[model samples]
Target: MEKSIHKDQVERFGSILLEIGSLLMSYGANSMRIRVTLNRIAKAFGYNLELLITHRALMLHIDDKDDQHSFNQLKRTSPHGVNFRLVSGISNMSWRIVSEKWSLDEIEKEIERLKSLPHYPRIIILLLVSLADLSFCRLFGGGMIEMSIAFGATFVGLFVRQEAVKKTFNPYICIFFASLASSLISGLAVKFNLGDHPEYAFATSVLYLIPGVPLVNSFSDIIDGNIMNGIVRGMHGMVIVLSIALGLALSLLIYQI
Candidate 1:
């Protein structure tokens, strides 16, 4: 928002700022972090920012110090997901912007690059998450047999979740299906007496779908005084919990346990 810059340039800058904020919000960043990051970038570019953040959208206003040139935009964010790499990358890029003074084009290109960065291979993630659930089962007093059951159940459940997400299913429905798959698999222990701690295996199998990030972020948002956003995120997490509970209940009914 420098006085020398044309209104068109200011508009473009505003658009980029909105894009960055939307990306952060969609990638599971807390409201405070998104606001702070956008403000940091705007300040570095000699502008002031006012932001309205929500779970599914972002609205921003930008103006020069003298209020000569101004821009306002509202953008709908992408479906919420967790990608800490993108969030941290953008935070670092903002600091770099402050020091190196990048052009809008350069910043746009960097964001694109970050978007294209590949996630960890799916098989690797599957193994790791399943291992983590197995560890959780053991920690919950499950024997080795229960841990093995948990590992297999989590692997299948997480795979279903990945495929459902790729198909663009509703998030809650996807979680429901994943929890159902996991609990159904773990429920086998009860049907066949394969493990001594079948209850532990069953309970821990769906732990992978607990919506931990959203719950934690919601708490952080509330603590930081973003009340509405916090409530929305918390509700989102609660719906996921409900979906999981329904899945578990169905499994229990099927097993009559």
Candidate 2:
């Protein structure tokens, strides 16, 4: 009966650890950070954890110090996205679990709450992203006309992306469409010679589609010796860039530029 109880406890820990690891993976946490966070939580529970992180899945092996209880699990992560809020929330929760010696139930509740946290409204995001792109236009030596074109193009493109995401389209497909939409709008400046730097407007309009998070995380993973995960992330970022290029190429073809 004691052994049964021990096994059950270990299994529960395994389930929670899988949940935590998968959440971190999906939200753009690097492998090192995820492994460290899991280790911290396991140490607080009087167990040790070994985690294997890949681009699409996580493998976990956890065993209590006594060696009497052990659990192994493999859980596939969801599609990756950038959510620094959730990543930081999970990191902080791990520290709390360690310092406060939180029970499994408490940790689980906190994870649920973090997952429920709402993002900024869509309209706010669209406006801010458009404004940022417009600023980039000016920073790149564009005049007011170029900035205006970039702003309008970015707004429309981002709106298309948001709507595509809502309908659950493939992420790369969404990016392609967004880029195409933005380029088509900004290309007008070049076609009509509306600005002194119409090329700057055309170029900066799709800058918002750059996969900055994945590219940064890829380098971090590589520097931390997670070569496989790093390569996969790097390839993923490159694919996104390729999608952007294809969209831009189609726009050039259409405008015969």
Best by TM-score: 2
Give lDDT: candidate 1, residue 205: 98
**After superposing candidate 2, which stretches have Cα over 4 Å from the reference?**
none
Score every model by TM-score: 0.97, 0.98
Off by over 4 Å in 1: 1-5
Scanning candidate 1 in windows of ten residues, the lowest lDDT window is 1-10
lDDT values, one for every candidate:
0.93, 0.93
